[model samples]
Target: MDDTLREDQKLTVRAVLAREGRGFAEEIGLGRTNNPASLFGLLVTAVLVAPRGESSGPARAAHEVTNRWHTPADLAAASAQDVAKELGAAVEGVDRGDGDDSASDTAATLVALASAVSETWGGDLRGLREKAGHDPARERELLTALPGVDDGVVDVYFREVQPLWDEVAPFAGTRALRAAAALGLGESAEDLARYGNRPEKIGRLAGALARIDVEGSHDEVRRTAG
Candidate 1:
């Protein structure tokens, strides 16, 4: 993209993110004062906890683990079986889909993310958090180290947590893609990325798309295309 176009896209993305962030914060009853680590843990929990039609049992469990362990590394140190057992206990009434896969995946991601932060960046996540401020590439790399976490997950993590780190223009994810399509931005994830990863633009697009109550809305359909 040209410099001018890139700048415009970024502005759009920022507008979208701001809107989405506000909605998400309100949904979860979180205040703006929460830090990145806190938000990261919360988001990760959201992933494990909130699949379609599911309540937030996994999120609550993950939060408890985070409170007790203090860091991903601390959680990572536990045996997979132990982690699964703990998570299962925490998410008591909810069916976690499979016996151990969910817990194992969560533990693996946490450990790998922690390890990547220490080995690749020469610091714990706390130290490497600065990468989001200085280098988006490094931030993406660090995020991808977590098992089962794809571009979508990474984008979500960055978008939600970036504000806590005092960073701007964190990447957009599926929600952003849907939003952009609603705003007539573009059709694919590639197109959205090309538009810049500003939160507000992405958030606005998503919110508009999500608000479509009509059946057969293109924005709603686009969400299932991937």
Candidate 2:
């Protein structure tokens, strides 16, 4: 990948990040923070956000459950019915316009996600990292094995977790890559990282790119870039 970014690329990176840079975890106060607490927040947020038609509903729902259960063990201990009640309350009257069915589905997914983490990694993602030998591909494979984790959810998790997991640095998923291409930042993770210009900036940039797609701000970002 090229080391230097064009003027448009630079502007796009700067503007998009300035406006919508924070990842879902960060917006919910997790902030790309690495610790078990933050990791649980990121993982659960990924699961919640992956299936929602719009992010705000899941984002609100994440706040509700994450605050209620600080750790995966706490969540895993709760009955799916109880989780559904909380998620339903949080998701109700949200912008996603989803009904009770959506909330119930999300509740089931959250319970399964927490149970998998609690049982497999003892509520600590570091165990998963160790099990994967810190290999990004292996980490991805292991992550996919977790309940409610599919390719899309993995993308959401990877974008946020890259800041914590060293081997996964400079990672960008399909959503981020699409946004990057729209902004002239190239289509590959490596290409996006070059535009980021620093190790720490890579995750943030990838996150911002993903948000452009999610929030439908690509054209606005492009205009800002120009």
Candidate 3:
């Protein structure tokens, strides 16, 4: 974002960003809209992507689910079986597993999550934020309590929504931090963010770093940067 950066460092970042400059939320069409519905979509994506080996399948499932359900109330109204069908269709060739119950189980958990959100927060995730009092640790604890949400989900959610949710801005989880260190971008989220020169850009940088890690493109990115 400034001329102070070494040319190689800027090139390395640009190479990675060219592949995926947007956070997962934005990649999935949720675009920093922090409304209840967009929050629901973010939650859906986090839940789907957590613990997954590759992102494509989970991303597809999330896209299908969010495209169908605009709100927690909408998702809560749907049958778990219908949601299962959607999930199954979304990842038809992804080989998440041959297990027949996988999609069904995920559907059940998601439906329960939607119901909990609708009942507890009156279909608004902002209430959860208010309850957390803008504390990241408290927010993580509360998110982990949601049905089907785990630490991995919380990490993904935090990374993707940091731009929109100032309460957790500039956050980089384990994957992003690891990628940053590997790319000579420093060991901390703040260090990685410093390259962007804007707080919101941290989410984009973090997401791009995570992608490099997941896709095993460290050498390629480094070469491009050089």
Best by TM-score: 3
Q: Top lDDT: which candidate number? A: 3
**Model 3 misplaced regions, further than 4 Å:** 2-4, 92-99
Rank by lDDT (best first): 3, 2, 1
Q: By descending TM-score, how would the candidates be arranged? A: 3, 2, 1
Q: State residue 11's C-alpha deviation in candidate 3, in Å.
A: 1.4
Residue pairs that clash (backbone atoms under 3 angstroms), model 2: none
- Candidate 2 per-residue lDDT over residues 102-207, each given as its tens digit: 5566677788888888888988999999999999889889999988898888877887787678688778888888888877778898887776545457767877
lDDT of 3 by residue, 97-161 (tens): 43557777888888999999999989988899899998989989988888999887888888777
Each prediction's TM-score against the native? 0.54, 0.87, 0.91
Q: State the lDDT at 59 in candidate 2.
A: 70
Evaluated at residue 60, the lDDT of candidate 3 is 77
lDDT of 1: 0.49
In candidate 1, residue 225 scores what lDDT? 35
Give the distance in Å from residue 114's predicted Cα in candidate 3 to where it truly belongs.
0.7
Q: After superposition, how far is residue 194 of candidate 3 from its true place, in Å?
A: 1.1
**Model 2: CA > 4 A from native:** 1-3, 89-99
What's model 2's lDDT at 43? Answer: 81
lDDT of 3 at 201: 83
